[model samples]
Target: MKRVLITGGLGFVGSHLTDELMAKGCAVTIVDNLSSNVMTPADYPGCEVLVGSIEEVYPTLLETSKPFDEIFHLASVVGPAGVLQHAGVMAQSIVMSGEAVTRIALQHGSRLVLASTSEVYGRAGELRESDGCQVSSDVTVRLEYAVAKLTSEVAALNRAKVTELQVNVVRPFNIAGPRQLPDGGFVLPRFVVSALSGEPLTVFGDGSQVRAFTDVRDIVSGLQAVMSSGKNGLVLNLGNPANEITILDLAQRVRSLAASKSEITLVDPKALFGPLYDEGIERVPVVEQAFSELDWRPVVSVEQTILSTLDWYRRRLGLSQHESVGVAA
Candidate 1:
């Protein structure tokens, strides 16, 4: 059995990754701060979940001499609203987690896969893996989070160059699906919940912003593909452009799919993000490299992902499905 360590293994992405890895017969240990997730070992049967920041747990982890075959670093201060709370500390958290995981992976000869963000591209479209992460001198929370994630990537690559540590960086664009909460200012979940509750789906900035929402299920599958493929020192953009849609269209789709009489209201984004928004123009990913290297491509459609998320919310909220959507968009 393959043994792996996942930092933030209980977060939205990390939790899905854990389910897949464990199903494939990999022994997975998780280190999550539980800032977003609230669960104990009873919630995740058969998985050892360590609840704390990586920095706080590093010393005890090293003392125990736990050897892992792979390390997946997915921990960070996420979402637009989430980063607003950590203006000065987001960059610090990114670097600290990067250093701890990089060192541990090096010590045990474990392959490393670091989760990054497409926010690093900064207002660019058709983002390729080779593009330099755009840096802004102004005070932008989104840019701060992006630069911090980029810093972590740089540090990991520097370490890989020296010790031959197999490092692959995954820059995911607009991810959504099960277990995602709207508290973090993620647009899709917020819209879905509002539509389901017979409330208006708020569209920030005329809902013109174009984003390609990749299902978390497909994203985790892409992560597994990166680990399975014998590649080293490569950066891959893992998202589906085929699922691209505008925010207004997304809201319309949600209202239509849920068969809700909810209205799609246009609201100023500043009202939502509270000076925490960056006007990024049409952020999409270039996934040719991921497909060529890992033989991976997202198979889930935007409509399918939306219905799947709606179904999850329905079950979680104790509401039955719409009774009309039978795997049909």
Candidate 2:
């Protein structure tokens, strides 16, 4: 069996990827600090769960000569609100985690996959892996997260070039699905929970921002494919362009799907997330590379993703799904 190490394996994307790798019979070892994750080590029975940061546990792994064929570095302070609220801590975590994981990969000759965000593009249109990142120079909390991710990417690529390690970067678009928390300023989960609770679905800044939201399942599959067959030192944009939608449209869709007597309300970003928050106008990915390289394309529709997310929230909140709220045609 292949041995795999995942940092932040308890997180939203990490958890899903852990499930996928375990299903494939890989001996998965997860290192997580559980800062933002909800699942415990007990949740994954067969896998080894080390309850600590990558910086702390990776040295022990090296000392013990624990072999890892693959390492997925997904540990980072995610979400707009979370990053903005704790910019310094987030930046520090990224730097420490990136260094530790890259060193581990080099030591063990393991294929390394780093999880990046579309935020690196920073208000760009038709985002491709080749496009130069337009990170803001302004002293805003948003730039801290983007800069940290970019720094990690550069460090990983530099290591790959020098050490000849197999390394790939995946910049995922707005990935939405189960196990996402509403408190992180993620629009979809907040809307789903509000709609289910008969509260208004809040739309920020006129709700005109366009985002390409891919299902978590599709994103995880693409990550796996990249690790398996992707060329070394390649950066792939893994997202479904077909699922692009406006925030207002997303709120309306969630309200309709939940069949709740909830209002769709518009709120300013300043009021909701303070002055540090700035909205991106558009985040559409050009994913032809993923298809040509990995033979991967997202199969889940936006409606299906939204419905599945709603179902998950319903179960978690102990609310029964309304039979009358059928899938929109």
Candidate 3:
């Protein structure tokens, strides 16, 4: 069995990835600072779990968890609120985490996959991996998240050229599904929670903002495929253009699905998130690369994602019927 380490392994996508790897008979070790996921070590009975940020616990990890066969680096400060909270230090934390993972992977000659965000593309529409990113301003906190992630990607790929560090980057577009926290500014979970709660589903701007939401399960599968892609310094886009929908339409769908009396409200984002938030343009990834290179294609429909998220949240809240709220903040 391949021995692997997943930073942020307890978080939404990472936790799902852990389940996948373990099911495949891989020995998995997971570390998370609990910044995003509420899961504890006890939550995962089979895998070894460590609780700390990548920068904080990597040293302990290096000395104790020797010779990892592969590393999945997904830990980073995330979301609009999180970015603004750690503004000046966000890039530093991200780059340091990348370097730490690179060193660990290099020491073991392990395959490494860095989970980069689609936000790096900034404004997007049917985006290819080759398209240049358009982060409006470095000073903007929202854009800073993208710029910082890109910096980490560049550093790792540059190292991959000369070193034995087997590394590739996967840019996932708008991941959504169970266990995704509303705290991270993820739209689908937020909408589902609000719809279940019979609260207004907030649609920022005109709600024409388009997004192609990829399910977390498919994303985890894609991440694993990258490790076997056998190409260093490769960058691939993982998304489902088939699931694309307008923000307003998404809100309406959620309401109908949940059978909620909640009004779909159009509100200024600034009114809710303050000035640091920038929603950017439509996110639509051209996923031909992931399909062509890894033989991977997103199979989950947008409606399935919504229904699954709603069900998960309902279960978490201990609700047998509709009405939900108190999602982790």
Residue 230 displacement (Å), model 3: 2.0
Q: Judged by TM-score, which candidate is best? A: 2
Task: Supply the TM-score for candidate 2.
Answer: 0.96
How do all the candidates rank in terms of TM-score, highest first? 2, 1, 3
Candidate 2's C-alpha lDDT? 0.86
Query: Could you tell me how far off, in angstroms, the CA of residue 328 lies in candidate 1 after the best superposition?
Result: 17
TM-score of each: 0.95, 0.96, 0.94
Q: Which pairs of residues collide in candidate 3?
A: none
Top model by lDDT, which number? Answer: 2
Model 3 lDDT tens row, 1-329? 78999999888898899988888999999988887775678889999888887887788777764589889998888765557688778888888899999988887778999989888887757789888777675568767778889999999999988877789999988889999888877788888888877688988899999989999989998998898888888899989999989999999888887877788888988887788777766878898878878967789999999989989988987777555553222
**Predicted candidate 2 versus true structure: per-residue lDDT over 15-95, tens digit per residue:** 999999998999999999988896789999999999998987888777646689999999888887877778667788888
Candidates in order have lDDT scores of 0.84, 0.86, 0.85
- In what order do the candidates fall by lDDT, top score first? 2, 3, 1
